[model samples]
Target: MTTLFDRFERAFMPNYGVPPVALARGEGTRVWDVDGAEYLDFIGGIAVTSLGHAHPALVEAVSTQVATLAHTSNLFLHEPEVKLAERLLALLEQPGKVFLANSGTEANEAALKLAIKYGKTTGRSYFVAAEMGFHGRTLGSLSLTGKPSIRDQFGPFATDVRFVPYGDADALAKAVDENCAAVFLEPTQGEAGVVPPPDGYFAAAREIATRTGALLVADEIQSAIGRTGHWFAHQADGVVPDLLTLAKGLGGGLPIGAVVGFGAAGTIFAKGDHGSTFGGNPISCAAALAVLDNVDLEHVRAVAERLRTGLEGIAHPLLNGVRGRGLWLAAVLTEDRAAQVQTAAQQAGFLVNAVQPDAIRLAPPLVVTPAEIDTFLAAFPAILTEAHHG
Candidate 1:
């Protein structure tokens, strides 16, 4: 049948390839494809759907806010915007200034620009980012991304970015000096196989940055917003970074991102340094506020605990170790069969992702019920068998 998706692919650039399934509707952790086939969604829109697809709270907030006030220029303030900023600040557990944008890449772009501006004053032009880190896809953020494959053709990127091995405190200390502007790391490396850093790595990085007068930046775009069972993954290490970039789940499936500058870091950018037109639109703020209100930290933590226990009980040779904090977990599969596993799981009425060749990442909606977990557990062995030997 000639469908809307087919028409879309015929006209649009073939950048992401053709999507296999065209999703039409969703409720909680389940989504219906255009063919009306239901599947248990575990990818959660690549971790963007915090409370899950079409959550009631998010629907109510977005619907009401859109009807009342969809957008007001940044020149004038709105109540929801003010309230969202305050709420994020409170959740961050820090005093800072926020610059809002429409995506993680944009947020990182603003942050990189801010770092460069601050570096200009300090007479240091170089910034360091960790290896295998996925910041974003824009020029500035792309330059900061540590993966060479993603940066291959986009070069002459915002220059002076140094790539350092992730979780290596000594390497960061060796690279960071008075001449360095900032050191950026993802508390939990999301796109690179859900890699968790070594213990005390972030804290040690903070100490190194302090000693060297370089700003410490944590790109928590994927690991923040209760994804790792914590408001921010860095909280587990008890270290606060100078600059933090947030997105992904911040807008509850809407488009929004934020660059939060802490303490002295906030003062680096003077007036007119950075701005965005649709960064903090009232509708986006309302959706984010609804996400915040629906997710309690304690409840999310409990959900993580339940998932960990359930996954541990499911046995398979390919399933080595499940690594992650909260809902952001990666099931370690043997070799490069992760893609096959994702395919098998999907065909078996579940949705999953192969974020890496050797790992399957599962960032299910926070609203996923215990029964959903049980369903996955029960069907896991067959999925693995099909993936391994199909």
Candidate 2:
């Protein structure tokens, strides 16, 4: 008998290839497919579900806000929107402006626009972005992204966008100049398989952007909201960016994106500059506020250490190393068999990601228990051995 997969192929767009499983329901860090096959959720909806699936707090917040007022457009004021913005600013510990959008790409596009508009006043016409850094898919943000395969066909991107090697302060310094409008980067290259920059790299980029009179925009989409045991990853580097773009884990599974501008960069937009119809939807903002309330740095730090020790403790060949901050980690495999490992793990009631050929990315829910980590660790060595030699 043809399953829902057949119907999915017949009805849905082929943009994402074909999803392997049809997840029916979830609770905490575990999910069950339509066939009732249970699996531990380490993907965390690609790191969007910060508190985990169907978290009680997130559910209550979303349900309450949705019933009260789902949306009022940007033309009207709402309590949830204002409150969420205020909360983010307070967490930032800095006075700035926040623009809410529906996704990380939109947030990035807004930041890019602000940078461009600011550049118009300063006589700068170019931008610098880190190579291998994943920004977003929108045309504007896509131009800022450094992946050639994603950009090569999407030609003539926002012109004068230059690429610099990530973590190389010298290359970044050389790329930024008086003519540069902004330097776009990530606190850590999360999509580049949990790659973190060297010590003081952000400081160097900050100094360069400041010296060159260019806005420094840090895309904290995958690294913020307690992912690194901090509100934002840049805080670890002690670098305050002129502009910050965030999403993924922001809204606790609800779609919400934000562009935070500091000091002068905050008010770069005048009236009628940029707007979003469903940006800052009350339901999404409420979900984000709940996540903010539940964010526990101490708990997240402990989880990170547990995962680090768990993965490192395994004395297996393929499972060679681990890298990342807090719960957003990558188990570096000895060979380019990450895809195979992910499949094998999934079949064994575990879920992981092959972010790259050699990197198995893991962004589990902040609510994941120590027992869950132990369970995955117990199966991980044999799983790697199977992928390696079996």
Candidate 3:
């Protein structure tokens, strides 16, 4: 019999490689493979499924909106788009203009354009981004990304982006001079094994950007929308970015992205600056609205605390520590055995992400229950043991 993976390998692009298992369905914090093997879901679709799979609110919003009205292109206006933009701005508690897109990369691409336009007006042409930080995989965003391994082959990119050491205030200060158009920072470097910057780093970046007359762009693609126990991760530093990019967990699963430009940055874009065909489509916007409506920040914080505490309490020799905030955590291993650990976890019926060779990222849905967390915590030591020995 031809398996689903065989069919997928035949039909799909090879960028993602062949996945280990073919997922059939999911509910809350659990998923089942095509073979009927069940697993506890901790990755949450790389932090995209904010409400878990088949969530009631997400399902209803998507179903209702798709049935009522779906795509209208940018040529027409829709109520869901307006409502979603308003809600995002409201959550920010700032006056801003929102540009919606289909994914985080698109959001970052839009932000890069805004930075370019700002540069045009200010006579500046360069951007400063953190080393080991990730914005997205698209050309513009990938140029801003500091990882040379993933980005080096695809370039020569068009953007003049400078790389600075992440969490180092002095390096950031030195990089953003008068000729710099923007300074892009991720509140927490998500793709770099969920690494966070030193305290006061964002504040210093804001000060530096202001002094140098550059736009401060926060790429909150992975750390926003209650993932970090805040509306946005930059809130932890109490610094308001000139431009903020958001996605991943924004739509609970359906693809959506947004860029919020505050104050002067909001007005930089002129008519016909940039646009997207599927951006802000009613279905995605409605799904995002449902995510905003149902995501409980307080519960998110509590569960995060429990999970963190449980992780920290484990006395395994292979355990190094934990990184990140709220539900977006990475378990640091003493050895570079994250891939082995991930395979062991799968065999033990749990889903986790080997984000790096030495780190396993855990970004479960906000609605994941205490019991579910406890189940993972209980099985984790054995999983580690199996990985260590196997």
Estimate every model's Cα lDDT from 0 to 1.
0.88, 0.91, 0.94
Model 2 stretches with alpha carbons more than 4 Å out: none
Candidate 1 clashing pairs, residues 3+ apart or interchain: none
lDDT of 2 by residue, 265-379 (tens): 9999998999999999999999999999998889999988999998888888787699988899999988999988998888889889999899999999998888998998899
Residues 42-124 of candidate 1 have per-residue lDDT tens digits of 99999899998888889999999999999887787899888988998899889998888899999898888888988888898
Candidate No. with top lDDT: 3
Question: Looking at model 2, how many pairs of residues clash?
Answer: 0
- Clashes by residue pair, model 2: none
Candidate 2 minimal-lDDT segment of 10 residues? 151-160
TM-scores of the models, in the order given:
0.97, 0.98, 0.99
Off by over 4 Å in 3: none
Indicate the TM-score of model 1: 0.97
What's the candidate order when arranged by decreasing lDDT? 3, 2, 1
**How many times do residue backbones clash in model 1?**
0
